[model samples]
Target: MQVELNSIWQLKDLDGLNDGLYRVLQLYPQDQIVIVFPLVDSKTLQRPIKVGFEQLNEALRVGKAHLSSYELPYYQLQSEANISASHLAKRNEKYSLIADLISSPRFLLDLVEQPRIKLVSLHAKKHNTYVQNLYRVLNLYWKYGQEKNALLPSYKNSGGRGKSRVAGTKKRGSPVQLSCPSFQAPEGVNTTESDKVLFIRAMKQFGLKGEKVRYSRVYDKMLKEYYSDELIAAEAESRNALIPSYRAFIYWIKKLFPAEKLIRKQTNQGDFDRNKRGLRGAATDHTEVPGSCFELDATVLDVHIVSEFQRNHVLGRPTVYCVVDKESRMIVGLHVSMEYASWRAGRQALINSFTSKKEYCAEFGIEIEEDDWPCNHIPQRLLCDRGEFICKDAEDLAVPLIGHLSIAPPYRAELKGIVEHRFNILNEKLVHELLGTTKGRSYIRSDKDPRLDATFTLREITKLLIDEVLEHNSSIFKDLAKQSALIIESNLPPTPLNYWKVHVEAQRHALSRVDEAHARSRLLPISKVTMTSKGIRLNDQMYYDSSHSDFNDWKVIARNNGSWPLEALIDHDNSSFIYVRLEKESGFTRCNLMRESVNFSHRHQADILFFEDWIKLEKSKAKPTAKSIERYQRRNQVIKSAKEELAQAPSLDSKSERTNGMKARRREAILAQRLGEEKPELKQENSFSEFDVYKEHSDHKKQKVVSMLKRKQVERDEN
Candidate 1:
């Protein structure tokens, strides 16, 4: 009565399965012919298989069509019956005899007239339970008098119905649906929501990593389109809920957006933190070869270098970016620049890393040999943090310069832990002991702490930093396991001078010009031609006679940046955007969409701005009255910062600082930042040293801006 099905190929052993069948004179002389097979495999029982009986009989072979993976096989039709090979194999001899007897056509025809045959029982997980349940519910709803689309069966509202059984709605007549977070990210969790982890995961699933940059704009497009759609269950972003302290918000925003910046954090907990002390954790090293990867990041000067440039823009404190071969921990490029950190600075880091050039050759009083590093096989990967200088726009300066560029995962500073940990050690052993009686400058104030001043300044600090780096490479880290201060063979395997020696002659020729340009070129100054509403013009001279043909119906704007390698801009006649002509590319590239949604946003902004500007104009036009608009200016800057942070997902353990400038392959990151540094601007200005002084006096600037804004608010309130 019961049998199991197994591999169909076993049927080849039976004469009943032969393609050219012979009518043998049987002793039973039965009319029906039956072929029985037993299930001997789990796969056969789990799924169904259907093979054309005629084809199997004709082929007489165990091939693809005659044998399918799905094994649950049985057929019975007028005077004929068949069972799977698995079933036949599993059946008892008595059942085998019955199968032989049923092989007669007469018996098969008679067996087909029988009312029914039964299956013994179904096994667990063999059933599609959810689909079955769904079908059952649908059948019952249709068969019974259950009202269509109603949450409850045969229930009525407003008449004589029992109280409803669900949250938010009675279960009687109304259809009920519940809204919840897509996943279980907390209601106020800003990190998960804004970081687009789910979206990014989907991208990874679909192999859309590189495509995300372009597709992300599509998402922005969608968000704008659905701006008015009801999105409930969202927390009302507030200053109080998020803005823990001014410091926290500043920290949060600093890590958002073009979220790469030279990071400087000190972790003295060394090899004792829960992380380092934990078990043999996931051993993560993407390097396939010893020197395949070279990671570089900059830390604040544990010690500074004195300014040596003619203009002598005293760096005050010098910083250096060191490239370390992950496997050997060799110093590839060791560059110590003054106060300026530019996109060019990042290129210098990369170039110096590979080529190992030195600006301080005279100071060292030695001509270091070139490294002659392999040119054909560039480092497989460049590892960097999100820093303005490194990951400047779409081109991602570091990535294109090498084969692959991998960002240190957000907050998982451990991925680049070597660099980070080394910096930490530098801070502890070198920077800490070297402060001496000298004082480091207070970032928050212009004045130095008397303790700090007698201790350290620009010259001494820079010198100390240089010495620390040299000492760190020349000594420490060779034996971290060693406790005592002892001489060790820690060394820069390939010095800056030696790096260039290994580079191939062809590579030398190819990158020689470009590399030199990268080093010394005025990156931010380049030539460009533009047209006003009138026509195509370069430096006010018309290049094209009139805006016609290619120039016809195109408007242009002067894009200012690099003063050489001329570029131009053109307006599109039909599209909702403009285009740019670059130094290399033949076609004009398009820009961000300022379309219907953007127009709508602008209009909405205009309404609010109109109200604001109106209020300002009205304040100038007329004096205050009892019902006058109260100027609550500068009331909640701290709160605004909190809101922005709260708009972010919850903090991961670490963060970075970066700026959004043009996503160009080559840019002067020094000047390539949004004019508004996403910070509340103050009246403080210094034309040449504006950015420099602001950075130097950041804390003082912060305090002054906060105070000045409050004062301005009070003055407005008084009027």
Candidate 2:
């Protein structure tokens, strides 16, 4: 092998030379001689020695001399920009002195041709370095690569960074100050191995997990447990104990246990994962376009609302459900109802998201163009919380509408943060300012009750919510990070409407169209309703009927036999109609509430169920009343008296004897009953004047004769 300059080699079994690693400093191939520098673990400079080329070649041929791998220094691997400015200035200054000599072509030749002692002496004199700075710079250059940055000072090794120093007898940092002259402080003590053991015990017992006690408490407990004797003596003498300070204890604790590990130990797994853990990625990383994913969640609003039927009767806070698109951060659907947050209310929100919004807004008395709040398509995937979506029914119903249903783990609200954050925006913007808001009254006493001030009905609150949703859709998004190509090209503001419109126009959305009737039927909650002879019965309270041809036949069959049950889809928000699946091959048929269940029409299913339960409870309460028991006993007594009267009468021996004088007895009984009743007396009247009476009689006779003549004439005309 050919020997090159600055190449390290291990010399073994070499004649008249000690076995060690050596580096070739200068090469003289024409003279058959070379200068080698010994590599050793010492900062002291070693003199280079000249050696014959043939001897080195023979050693290498026999495998006695071979190239050795050199590990790079830490400073060599670091970037030059990271080095301190002072260090860089000093490095440049050192390199400037030896620049001409190193850049010359005869520098290596001179190292081989000139005597080593004379060369060192001349460089020391030329550089005016009595302490051998010239030799140090040259040595660093040859030890590392032949680069200017190689002359940089090793300042990283000077301060003993990242290393623990052995404890001395005295203190380590500046002395502490006393608050007063009478108050004595502890004699500063350096941290020792024994003190560290006590710190570990205290941290494990009091500071690490279970209950998060304060650091001061841990320090006090440590002193009481580990240095009790010293503490007692100090207290007795009116002085402080000679123990490690709280700062030193905290230092060792942090050194032993990391902050993240301590946090995990202190909190529960769910809390730590939800609150303290670092976010692994964004929720929208997998979603490429609008409608790719949607988040569904519900929250109880802060304001109280009144019932639609009775405005004076204040219903408690209403629950609002919002579905937000993950890509655009837009609320695609919204629902506000008196019912609590459950699957019954959640499905209404989903139905709103999958159907048209024009008619829905119109029903709320908030007319809007289609583009005002235009989000009426099913998403590819739906992400929801575990409350309403972690059930078999939710999966069975929503999976077919939206391509997939993803339920987030319990307590992990961040998984559906898009919708969860929308609740805060809504409360801040609208609900908190309402008349009967309970936002700040939860923990404090107020002069007036919020319920008494409630004025907005449920329908009115819903209209306000729809208006807010429209405004939110058109408002600019403050935290929108991802943008589509079409949005960037058009340079539109980052509003949900803009993002949605541009993507839809370019056909970059993942929205899919579904039949509104099919979606509504599938999303409605299913329950068994009896097919009765009168009509279809729901929950044994509400009755329904359909105009379908088979319904009449089914009713007839039910009348002949017993009532049979069938599965029907129920819309909990409105009891006016229910969708019934008659056959496997047919779609759902709409059934209207019957006249018998007219009280339940336009009422919430929850209200109807509540009424039924309340009525049953009232009946149960009234059953054991004293009045009811007395009435029952009085009826039994009356029946007993009638039976006795019947027994007193004689019995007929044969049918002929019983029927002998039935008609005569009935007439006699009728006459006897009439005779027992009283009759009214008649009154008489008379005239006193004779002339007046005679004149009245004459005029009456004349009128009668004229009438007779007129009647005869009429008869003759008819003949």
Candidate 3:
């Protein structure tokens, strides 16, 4: 057998030689002898041995020696990807020195053929000691497959990594430095086995628990529990010198307990599972395609807004509900209203998502083509938080529109991170810069109030939000867009709209259509409305009228049998119309507010409710005023005066007399009251007419008297 360079040979039962592995460094074919070196520690320099080819072949045939290929250990095979920049640079430097020695065949053969000691002496004389032994370089080159990375230092074995050192009398770490020159630092103590036990006990007692505890507190507890009473009674300096320091305790605690373990133990199980745990998979991994899943979430906007009707009246922050597609990260639907974050508001958002966007945008005075914002279908599954989508009503409505309803566990916002993150984007991109924005106001002390700065009405803000949504949907989303295989194949820019369009064209979407009216009726919140004699009363404030055939009949029945309640679906965003269900089997009947409730037309239920609350507040404020008190006092006085008059008035002698001339007495009293109340000026103007009437009576009497004894002179005295 011929001995080849860089071939490792293990001698088993060789006489007069220790059995070990050796590498063939150089071959001398003319002499039939090979130069070989022991593959031992690179730090030790060993002279190469010359072995005859016949002798190696005879040993191999006798099974006393074996030929084996050299393989690098796992730790020695470091890839460039895993290497740090500094370590890689160091490795490259080492490889550069020996690059020619390993690569050039003639130079390597001539260099390794020289006598080993003479070679080392020559290298040392030339000051070219990149390695301790030139023969060891060849040994490693042969051992690790002759790669540039083969020269990398075994840093993994340095610094006693992952090994605990035995405690001794001498200190192990840097000495503590005192901040003040006058202060004396405590003498360091080696962390003994007992101290490690104390640290473990303290960490298990305090640090590793649901409630977060300070390391300082844990150290104190350990010192109190483990230190003897005599040690505790010692001076602070002496006690610290005898016992382990807080820093030592911390070092051991960290060594025993990893950061992840401590964090898991110190945080709530839900919080840890939701936020601190590693994300093994993505939301898109579960959503197979666009519209496969929609995430719903609502947030109170940072900016204050005014009422649509009254711009000067700040309506406070409005709740904005957003629906995001899990696969494409598109803002499929949105609802902004003064209503609080409730199922009612979230339902409107879902309805908006399921219906066409063209008409919805038109309502906000924004004109756009169908393709500009073309997310108008129900998703196969809906993922949402426990807030709005966990209720029975939501389950009933949403489970039908979306085939599956996924209610995320409480406190896990990451489950609906798609929509929750959209809210942050909306606030950052659009809301934070708007007038009356409350962002950063918490830390500001300026006299300017965000509420007072509110200039945009609810409608104006809604329009702006629609425009933002359009822009956001069209904007390029680098992370989400580039993740799509279809978009990459099509070489399209990764905007949400582009991604959605690509998938839709490829028929890789799970969107389904539902009747708009049916979706609206099912998703809108349901409430009970009373059918009264006057009209259908809603919330006992606004009344509605339906033109159905049974409307009048229901009204008649209600009037005769007292007010009755019927189930109705209300769109909280619009108080103008409500869908009323008169019968169990019948569909929802559209009802408009009665004429009496015209004031509440085109208004939100929140606005009407707020107005009612404002009115109540005003009444409450007015009730305690001086004028109100005086009015009540006057009313009491009138009652007292009427009681006094009744007491003074005479009683009828009999019931028969009281009824005998009731009509004549009433007429007389009315005539007396009219005369007493007549103005003086009117009385003077009528005086001449009265006198003329008296004169006519006298003349008539005189004429009659003349016929009767001529002259009684009608002296009738006009009597």
**Candidates' C-alpha lDDT:** 0.38, 0.79, 0.78
Ranking by TM-score: 2, 3, 1
lDDT by residue (tens digit), candidate 1, 292-400: 6777777555443322211122224445566666543445555555424454445555654453333333233334333222222236666777653334441444455
Report the lDDT tens digits of candidate 3 across residue range 1-719. 65676788898766545688888777778877676766675565565566777777778899878887666777566667897788688667666555655565454345445644354355444556744645555555655656666666677678998998888788888888778999887676788997788788878887788968999988877777778664656764454437777788878888988888899998898888777899987767887789888988888889988876568888888888899999899999988887777887888988889878987787666888899998889898888878787788987777876889888887888878788878888888989999999883473675678898898877678889999889888888888754678888889889899999999999999998878768877777668888888778987689999888777888888889998788888876567788888788988888888889888876766678778887888788774678888999999999999999999989988989768978757755675566568898876687567656756876798787433455453333543
lDDT of 1: 0.38
TM-score comparison, 1 vs 3, better candidate: 3
Residues 432-549 of candidate 2: C-alpha lDDT, one tens digit per residue: 8999988734735656788888988766777898888888888887445355666668888888888888889989989998877789877886678888888898887788989988
RMSD values, in order shown = 35.8, 10.6, 13.0
Evaluate model 1: give its TM-score. 0.29
Clashes of each: 80, 0, 1
Off by over 4 Å in 3: 1-161, 175-187, 211-214, 228-240, 305-316, 337-340, 440-461, 489-491, 525-567, 581-586, 589-598, 614-719
For candidate 2, what is the TM-score?
A: 0.68
Cα TM-score per model:
0.29, 0.68, 0.63
